[model samples]
Target: MSTFDEKLKLFAVDLYKINAIKFGEYKTKVGLITPVYCDLRVIVSYPQLLNTLAELIIEYIKKMQTFDIVCGVPYTALPIATVVSVKNSIPMVMRRKEAKDYGTKKLIEGQFKEGDNCLIVEDVVTSGSSILETVKDLKNSGIKCSDAIVLLNREQGGEKLLSENGIKMHALLSLTQLMQFLKEANCVNESVVEKVKIYLQNTQVDPNVLIKNNRLKLSFLERLNFAKNPVTRRLLQVMCDKKTTLCVAADVTSTTDLLNLAEQTGPHICLFKTHIDIVEDFHPNFLKHLKEIAERHNFIIFEDRKFADIGNTVQLQYSKSMYQISSWANLVTAHSVMGKGILEGIQQSEGLKDRGVFLLAEASCAGSLTDQSYVDATLKLAKQYPDLITGIVCQNPLLLEEPGVIQLTPGVHLESVGDRLAQQYNSPETVVLEKGADVAVVGRAITKSADPAAEAVKYKEVLWAAYEKRIASQ
Candidate 1:
């Protein structure tokens, strides 16, 4: 074997010896239980292992065409970069998780001029957020960074996400490789290897197909690979995993009725949407119980706030208001009438990455002023920020087939055509099958039924059947 190859084998063994890769039931940051947890943070304690890892990274870096300096992600990657810099005589810079308040108060603590090409070194890559964050900081300081090197890649969506941002990811080792070494060494059983393989496949988001002209052609399982927003991704995963696309709009006026409806219909629905401001008995405990039910039922909570104010006002209304919707709601509704600033404001709130907004492009209510132009503008805005806007709430399919922006059709009813208030209703076929919408939001049809749970089951069956038919026909 080559020298680099020999070092790589030794590095893998060292990783196992140091217990950097542990075999057990561990809950990931997003609450998914995994059979193994690869924590590279422990590698810093072993100088020899750390040096070998840095050497492996340096060997890979030498193959690169060119780079000016090297930078490491905060905390875990700091020492790795330090070793690589010292051993290879490469200049190094540091990125701070939080900017120092005193001294120079620099976010990036290094002496580097602008326009220098910096290669980012990270200990582990998951969603590629850390490398992207460091890239953003470097860009703001006029430093150029187009490549990143990680000790190990979890093989989730990190590489794809980084490529989407014009950054290339180079990993010294992948999770699959580590698993192979463990399996060969008898460090983990076959079942653990299979479990990790399944986990990797579940989180892998491939970009082979474009959604431009293929929106109607892709199934939920296929579309999950393209969704950028975490909430959107989780929703698609839930729908595919649960085999339902029914969203129950709990429009009841009391928290008691809301919780009752949620518990009854949670099994058959992917989203439990609410207008929390209308709840007569709202309390902190209400939010707690609702979230607990959602967790147990494997559905997301959507608060239909319909926010349409200025940026500053909407920011406070989303997170700092009496309701604090951002604290619990995984999905929210917002009107793009006030411009993209409304999106910016919402994104600035806490836990923005975990939450998503649905733009109201068309309403099921009659005489709604959302015309074609307004819908077009709303879709245009949503396309600009795929990470923030999950989809558009509309009565009809959009003319533009934008990727990753799902369609949520509301006012769905099985029998009713229209109410006295001019609220138009469509069947599950019209929404999911005919109009190419992803979700059907049914309110009074199920909520006001004699047995909400049974009624929800009916909607769920029809909705999932329609979705299956749509994708099969494609």
Candidate 2:
């Protein structure tokens, strides 16, 4: 039997053919005339193919460790999620658009605890509005949606929207990947592939169009310039559209270890997050070295201080404090738990404009206190101070109502349970993909592994599988 990776490669090639064969002149839901159409609902008819597909997805999930539950959206995704759940011996949840008054009287029917983390699975994403709605329903029922996995992302605005709203999205096959697969399989001519590329290019040419309704629009290039303002660009570089890789703590005990890991996982991640309080040894020399490495590796350094104080105190922490956090760190994590005034203090500092600040809204740990009170308060604060708050770190996927607040989730682990000597988080690829996480904060699995490079490859493979599965479904 072929290894999962080989099978996945073959499957992507087959899926590309299926998509190309199915493609024809068609009108999209948005009324755009297109030369191709992808509806993965037909894949269910081929039991063997479907089974292999499910196995591929399960393989990625198992690699991350087992999850507590797998949840699928209404209509198409339910069957796929069901197969993965059954095959992996995990429970599954379903989110209905509206409450069913007849049978269950339920909108979200599953065996989930109020704070239980769930991975939301979907077939495909176009505009991402439907998934956001699903996330809202999941949160309303008191479930934590930290990650989302899909079959295909059309390289549309969905990824950005999901990321902006604080959900990390992973795809088994992205549009680009699928197109390449089609080219390799000879299913699509170069002209058709070029058309798809043009479609994506045109879509991204204007960020304003993507968020016109929300009145929030800034092209990635524009955002890059915005990030470069003398105040902001020095510490952080917003590499990807929405996701960020953050260094968790900056204490001397783990700084070197964390920086080393960040360098190894650079291209796969976006931001390097850190908490200054954890650093035991503070020195200008260390800062200089770390900054140099960050530049060399193409990642941003985030200071995850979770700052919650008055303006003067916050200013002191950023500028003249003992740690002098503003000197080297690019992004900062703060708690909106205090309100808008606290955010204003940090945003007003010199050389801080480009420095994105992630607000703590919903957090991932087992016993986080992000209840309804916190959600309401955070949403209110988010609206009042949108400019200062670059993103919100929340476990609740529904908390992504507003734009500009980049959602960064930590507590990301591939293994559900660490070996006998270590504790496990059981975060499967399915969970991460379904919940629509922006950037997953992974440590032990990558750092503690005998081969960090291999461990990183495992994550990239699993993530790629999730992306492909989503695309095939779409």
Q: Best-fitting candidate, measured by TM-score?
A: 1
lDDT (Cα, 0-100) at 52 in candidate 1: 80
Write candidate 1's Cα lDDT for 89-153 as tens digits. Answer: 88998886544323564667878888999999898777676687688767767899899999788
**Please, what are the lDDT tens digits per residue for candidate 2 over residues 296-347?**
7666777878888887788777878777777777678778666776777777
**Lowest lDDT block of 10, candidate 1:** 204-213
Could you tell me the TM-score of candidate 1? 0.56
Q: Which stretches of candidate 2 lie over 4 Å from their true place?
A: 1-259, 399-404, 418-428, 464-474
Clashing pairs in 1: none
What's the true lDDT of residue 309 in model 2?
86
Give Cα-based local distance difference scores for all models. Answer: 0.82, 0.63
* TM-scores for all predictions: 0.56, 0.51
> CA shift at 464, candidate 1, in angstroms?
0.8
